[model samples]
Target chain A: MTDRAFAVVRAGALTSVQDRGRPGHAHLGVPRSGALDEPARDLANRLVGNPLGAAVLETTLSGCAVRPRCAVTVAVTGAPCRVTVDGRPAAWGAPVRVAAGAVLDVGSAADGVRSYLAFAGGVACEPVLGSRSTDLLSGLGPAPLTHGTVLPLGPVAGPPVYADAVPWQGPPRELVLRAGPGPRTDWFTARALRTLVTAVYRVSPAGNRIGLRTEGPPLERAVDGELPSEGMVLGAVQVPPDGRPVVFLADHPTTGGYPVIAVVKERDLAAAAQAAPGTPLRFVLTERR
Target chain B: MSTMRVLPAGDRALLVELGSGEEAEAFHAELLRRRARGTLPAVREIVPAARTVLLDGLDDPARFAKGLADWEIPALVSGAGSTVELPVRYDGPDLAAVAELWGVPAGEVGRIHARTPFRVAFCGFAPGFGYLTGLAERYAVPRRSTPRTAVPAGAVALAGAYTGVYPRSSPGGWQLIGSTDAVLWDHARVPAALLTPGTRVRFVPEEG
Candidate 1:
């Protein structure tokens, strides 16, 4: 195959192509879908010498495996995982060169929830709205990666970075998110804010790409019924009728009716993506955004 | 008109609240005009909803929000947007209920709904699906107490003061009144959604 493609050998539990998500389409009810762990995806891209927003594979919990049609340099980041080339151990966070026809395996996460794998020249799938990201919400772009799926690759962009020591922050023992007020703060009781900060919350197993469901104290509503549908931004701490706050993520609906009590800082959300199920989450209410 | 209130949604987004859906639509139209004319500041997304418009990915959310206070928004141009015609068959199960709600004979339901012009107020619930406004407040209807397990694609429905066509098969609560053959969503097409925010629409009745 002269097409420079990588065939999925072991399709993990959930794997999809992602880059900087297709934005500017929220008005059409399109979610801004992209890499959950932005910094880790960027680091993988940097190691493989691809552009900042080049497409890469985002593997959930159990990682995926791929075999390139041509010699390639690849890097795996995000959740710490066991990576192997042709049944031999390979670097997990650093770039490794693999010859054509060799199986590159990315195993299950040791701590985090998602892992990012970037290949040299990036996955060159036909861009939908100028993104390769698979939006689970709108069902846009490519579908989730499956075994035998062959994805084309773009031409190499730049030289790969082989660093001696790259700063790697391990997955948090307890997730801390700094949150600021949302537009519908008045909908919740005064004690709701206190409960939000003081109450213990864990990342629920029901969480998906759309939002992080939290198992915690249900916030008391000051008002009754739902609001007229309003735009939902990333990190929106929306309190549903059930009263549990669900933190909006990359594939969140463009608009929602549930009242949003607060919005976690965008920087803090990258960590939220890697948070494993049952990980303790703390929402620190801050005066300033 | 009440002053447009700009509330903070997050550090990256600001929500501008309008008095009603009509005002929100008008503001969205004006914002589109400014964005097209290169007058609006650099922002990532402009999402319109029931009574608000959210501006996201702003470099300085505070500054952009402060500008809203100093500006005057123009009203939306009536009958201005691109109009799409849909051939609809009024064969829904709730046709009688809707007719009773309108105090009109079952036969008149199709004629009355087909006559009114519609505009897409905002899009939500799903992609390619638009919340369309056309009927007056008196024509508004409540949603079904028990929503359908699956509302088929191209199903024309009504809720509150809005009418919408289901883009694809999904669970929905709107009262189904008719059906359309026109594809509401086609991702392969240039503009995937047949109906978008601010679009004008007219339904033509299909002969039995």
Candidate 2:
């Protein structure tokens, strides 16, 4: 009822409210569903003078459009895109003030698969287990934004902070990851490990928030039987019956029946988030102990 | 031999391997006890499974992995964890099939299952679905060769050496023998899942 809210004008492909996400609940089968690009969300918050962990809008592929009910300061980061205020062009990675009822259009991503938008006051939605992130797997938090959806805004804590520039890391053309040893590495054949690091892979269209399914040479296994469902961790490179490695993402299940060949370093996962389907990928496997 | 080993899961987690599910349950208990007593490092989640326990969100997993070999895990703390009694109806399509597998009368399956106490070895497949272990290895049953497209929620099922109630409708290969009315998971509820690892489960037969 209050005027401190915005109405969705264009919901784009997939847009959801996300924060740092509800972690530490994996034992109860909750996935750590946070913004894939944590740094991008942090930068967007900094420009809008919101807390680093404040909830922001994460838009996939093409961006979104919104009309605020009140005057607000906003910023956009992650995957460079054409941002426009009403009919005029606006800054892409910097703060921009918009009048009440003005349409803020976030156009198709120029280079990345996702873009982040932050308001001076973060999106104030009902938090579930200490997060507002929409978990696609568990169906927690608010549902994905639809056209005409009204989202409440929290009270602004401070004025917008203007910086000289916020560096934008372009989306990865060739997604390279630093992989480490696994808990179930012995499940694979000795030659499998060698094939894993040397094989050329591409991001399959089947990739999602749960995992990045790879299309590559199948890793041969020493053990043919399925694992007795074991606890899985973030960044685990789980190989199914088919042998293609799947890199677990934020929304991955806590346990799986597949054997993990290796684990991708946490630092490199941000680039994986923006990798479009068919992006070439290489694994630089670390020494096995 | 009480075999135990630890493997590093990237930089943030360590997977402790045990010889059996019972050992995993005991080790998970030790980890929880240490966590409560402030002896263990501040890790996010310590998840148990069939024969492995994952220590996640640790700052330095290698340091913890090195110390695991020296620690002696105690036996499971009897009567320490909460026990849940589930009232189930012995009317499922797979009841006859499961009864045949056990070489018992169809009607006797419910009574036999209700008498034994099952402990949750771990939870996986979906939210709130706990893999309960108690039946001896001799009772291990093979999963359905072709999984049903939709196993209704609350279906009490068996596979291998474990029994579980489906928390939600999902495609599963387990042999179903009954159904329960209890809600296994509710996001609005505190703790969300009704069955967590280390809990004791007792199935009670509902009057037909």
TM-score of chain B of each: 0.97, 0.96
Tell me the tens digit of each residue's lDDT in model 2 across A1-289.
2499999999999999999998888877778888988889999999999998799999998899999999999999998999999979999899999889999999998897889999988999999989999888777789999999999999997888889878877899899989998878898898999888888899998988889999999999998876888888889999998889999988898888899889999999999999988999999987776
Where does model 2 exceed 4 Å of error? none
* Candidate 2: residue B5 lDDT (0-100): 84
Tens digits of per-residue lDDT for model 1, B66-183: 7777667777779898999999999998999999999999989889899999999999888888999989999899999999999999999999988989999999999999999999
Docking class of 1: high
* Clashing pairs for predicted structure model 2, backbone only: none
Displacement of residue A88 (Cα, Å) in model 1 is 1.0
Residue-level lDDT for B183 in candidate 1: 94
The worst-scoring run of ten residues by lDDT in candidate 2 chain B lies at B1-10
Residue A31 displacement (Å), model 1:
0.6
lDDT of 2 by residue, B62-172 (tens): 888777768988888677799999999988888899888888899988887888889888887788989998887766789999999999999999999799999989989
Q: Residue-pair clashes per candidate, as listed?
A: 0, 0
